[model samples]
Target: MNIVLFGATGNIGKVILQEALDRGHHVTAIVRDPAKLSVQNPNLKVATGDLLRPASYEASLAGADAAIASVNDPDPDNVPKQAQVLLDTLAKAGVKRFAWVGGAGSLEVAPGVRVIDDPNFPPAWKPSAMGMVKALDVFRASKADIDWTFISPAAHIEPGERTGKYRVGGDQLLVDAQGNSHISQADYAIGLLDRLEKGDAARKRITLAY
Candidate 1:
């Protein structure tokens, strides 16, 4: 696969970049500073661009088989706007395969309740979580001629060893025997790549856990 990735230097994005390259897929990463990528492979290509100015990275989508975004906007309120920009630009660029690195807050804890709805969802995280919730809404309601997937990680994700073992679920948060929900960032990248390679969960949100 020839993949074009945004935020390829981020905490999770960099892991995705390495996973894609390790799988022998060609990747063209659009970044403001390519120096931060730090990965060198014959299949890896770098392009200069910024998400703030969609036009700067619009041309990078040419010949891309899939586009993945792992973007972060500190303001939280701007998340949906960011998602919209990606969808609109990718649509115009004729890139149909799209995936967003989503948040776990939107995952349902019950039939009609979300993790963010919990009383202990953490005040600091709600703003960003809500931003992603609205971003997911944008993806769900989007009429773009694109196949989209929103991949959410476990409720608790951080740097950890990659065991390459995990479970996949939709809508609901996955928990283990200890009632814990978490997965290593490296394994999470593997899960995302698996979905892209297998074409799983199109037009829906799938989550990862261990």
Candidate 2:
């Protein structure tokens, strides 16, 4: 498969890039800073472009099988706008499959309560998490030609060893007996790429945790 990825330099994006390359798929990463992507593979191609300027990379999406977006805008106000740009661009490029790295905050902890709204939720993480929640909605409401999938990582994701093993769930948060939600970055990458290859959670939000 030929995959076009946005935000190749981000935390989750880096692992996704490596997983795609390791699986022998052709990858074209669109990023603002190409230097940050240190992975070298014959199948890997890096294209310099900004998500805000979709026209700049329309050519890059041509002939691509799928697009996985991991773009993160620290500014709360810009998250939805950036997500829309990517979706619109992919739609115009005629790509049919789309998957985005999403957030767990939007997942309901209680009937109507969200993680981001929890009083115990960290103040520093609220902006980014809430942004992702909004972005998730944008993807869900899109009526474009693309078949989109939104993959939300576990509540606690960080660099860790990949056991090639993890649990999957839908909508609600995944937690263990100890009441913890976590997943290694490596495993998250594995899960995302696996779904990309199998077309598992088409047009839905699937989450990963312990």
Best by TM-score: 2
Model 1 Cα lDDT, one tens digit per residue, 33-78: 9888888899999999978688798777888888999988788888
Off by more than 4 A, model 2: none
Q: lDDT: which candidate is best?
A: 1
The runs of at least 3 residues in candidate 1 whose Cα sits more than 4 Å from the true structure, single-residue gaps closed, are none
- Output the lDDT of residue 163, model 1: 93
Give the distance in Å from residue 37's predicted Cα in candidate 2 to where it truly belongs. Answer: 1.9
For 1-210, candidate 2 gives per-residue lDDT tens digits of 999999899988999999889999999999988888898899999999988888778889989999999878768768888888888889888887888989889987888887788899999998888889888888888877777889988888999999999888888888888999999999999999888888878888999888
TM-score of candidate 2 to 2 decimals: 0.96
Error of 1 at 197 (Å): 0.9
lDDT, model 1, position 42: 99
> Worst 10-residue stretch by lDDT in candidate 2?
71-80
Q: lDDT for every model? A: 0.90, 0.88
Residue 126 shift from truth in candidate 1, angstroms: 1.4
lDDT of candidate model 1 versus the reference = 0.90
